[model samples]
Target: MVPITRTVPAPSSVRTARAPRRVTRPAIPGVVLAVIGLGAMAVVSLWWRDTPVIHGFGAMLTGAGQVLGLLSGYGFVVLVALMARLPPLERGIGADRLARWHAMGGRYVISLVTGHVLAITWGYAVTAHESVTSEAVTLLTSYPDVLMATVAWFLLLGIAAFSARAARRRLAYETWYYAHLYTYLAIALAFSHQFADGASFAGNLAARVAWSSLYALIGGLIAWYRLVTPLLMFARHRFTVAGVRPEAPGIVSVYITGRDLDALGAEPGQFFRWRFLARSLAWQSHPYSLSAMPRPDMMRITVKARGDHSGSLSSLRPGTRVIAEGPYGAFTPALSGRRVLLVAGGVGITPIRAMFAALPRRMSEGITLIYRASNPRDIVFRQELDAIAADRGAVVHYVVGSRARLGYDPLSALYLRAMVPGLHRYEAYVCGPAGMTRAVVAALRASGLRRRRIHHETFDF
Candidate 1:
């Protein structure tokens, strides 16, 4: 294991006074859900008011299509808003949970769109005494914005296909990220078609205005949070690459130097979407957790060579400009119990390592960290971890070995109970690869911890 040292002094640009306390708002998620539910109710009411009577099968199908289209449009707004990188939602709800919601919501919205297209085409065909295929062609050729809508539908379908687990695994991270940006174009095309042909909006100024307002609100949020905020942060902080130090064979820590970094309010377990302004790296931004505590003028993020983007960070030159978009995620020690248990697997040790150092100095109970690695050499920051554990009077356990060599999984429920008695009383924080994280979480639950007591975040998305 490589030894590391921290001797950098606080820069003059940072405030000498204490940092302000962060106010935690736990009700943001519930409030957001309530707002979504209200919007859905309004959509249903609009359909109910506009669609009073249904006499024939064709009318019924058309009505169903209209309802589906309305809900889907509203859903698109909600979907984009969820991922707008808004601080409240990102910090309050956590990025991982929001990502899960966005993914599941995308599937539902796609299904609704597919059903709308089929039902509308078939219903129009029956009403006009024509075949489904004929009606579809006619709609595309004759209806205002219908061709654009059709194009948008196909784009959405393609995106959904690529977003699947298997497809995502085959594609590079950059490709997947850039492909998802086409969602903005698809939503714009769909919006035009909605106003052009929607029954509820036909000659209804109030309905059109309301729908337009909703879109504008969500668009404004995306513009401000995703675009404007980052620009402002970049200009204010003027971040740059200070240096990069190798930790292991394929892992290195990037030290970022900036102005007034403390003003960014980054906690130990939070992360930033880092965009390095350099050849082949300027266009893509990747999320990397801070491996150490934030300083007034510097911060550190440890990256493992998991992919092309991460692998290339080893070559980053000092003084390279950097654009960061966050201090996001809610995985800090604020939510942990008196007696805390920290679990880390492989590169997941980055965030866990930071939190371990930040744990309260005097705990009534104690703090324990279990690091799972495939081998002794794979253990990162070993010297630093031992130093912190000894200085803080915390316990550090390194579980090193492959499953085959060990003859069993060391992180199983039975083993966890033997390793740490009364595991249920401690709040656990886990970070690691998706498979290992899931296994550890399952083991923790089985060992008597409640779901709420265990916190974890995966970067698989």
Candidate 2:
């Protein structure tokens, strides 16, 4: 840990003129996805409307059930596509937002499917003049594919129950991740029923082809990006742990060496889900942001001992085999705006450090880092930060104190406004623990920075 120190005063000669904005690649707007989703729902509703029999209570109930079923199918395919790790969405919308979208979309699927079950069963019972319970059991046992679909319904409900915030917080990341994989199985079973007896597709060849094509495209994306691409990269790169070094107490940096790693195309501030083939470690993979720019043959990821998995990183020996699944994240220079302001709390500094190294700058007056930690001992890479600051003419401000202590305030809006001159003129990059991120984001917004200019990355489930 480095000692608490005041930031270097802004160079008097530093111009007050606002830094010009960096031209960014035009991102495919997120609303494009929203519009498509709405359009698919409308298509289903239109299909229901075109039906010959349009009136009775039982008929209407069945019709509504069919619409809900169609929407759930749309939800299944789109949700899977979002998680397929496509490069376009990964680079444009980013991992954090993508995960959030998937979660919200999952909620919609739950509602749609739940409605489908109730409405379909109720309608059949009314038409047959049987009890709802008997109708449900009859459908499950008698209908082709319905029994499998019933299994899928229960699987989906179980997933939804565990995905609730309270339940998810108690589960291990590995456990939660593996449980989610069952979603693929659930969708497969559900899709089979759609073809066997789906009201919308009955006697409709065009509908069958369109829906099948959608699923086939999604399958190809998953097979290529999730399975085949990773295997090819593994064979080509042959990544292996070169060494692990402690940067601070309970924090270690792992150096990975591989063949032709330059071809990986990983940028600073990006992360990879690393699966190390070692004792007690081969069971799961974890995301760690790159702590340094990747070289042709090697790369580095810094980890803090936050849990059993992360704490055990220091125990990994050199020469361990590694499989990495990303280069994922949008927290890079591609999102840069005007001037750069890097805000790092605890180990969140990992990505900030890498970005600092790669930031092309003749003068760093416009670049500043606000490194926050509870105390000096919690700070990592203090020496390297100073070296980079000295070489790049940037300033590093270590805000060290416990937030719970009285008269121990740092990282306040006032403090930030003073530390980074022309506060509203910079494009701020913030990475930290959840609490700190929320606080810093609020502070940045209070100080007049636009939401668009403050880019951050998070994987907090």
Specify the highest-lDDT model's number. Answer: 1
lDDT (Cα, tens digit) per residue for candidate 1, span 90-163: 88888998998899999999999999999999989888889999999999999999999989999999999999
Clashes of each: 0, 0
- All predictions: root-mean-square deviation over Cα? 3.0, 5.6
Q: Which model scores highest in TM-score? A: 1
lDDT accuracy of residue 21 in candidate 2: 26
Candidate 1 local Cα displacement, residue 190, angstroms: 1.5
Q: Candidate 2: lDDT of 43? A: 58
How does residue 187 of candidate 1 score in lDDT?
A: 95
- TM-scores for candidates 1 onward, in order: 0.94, 0.91
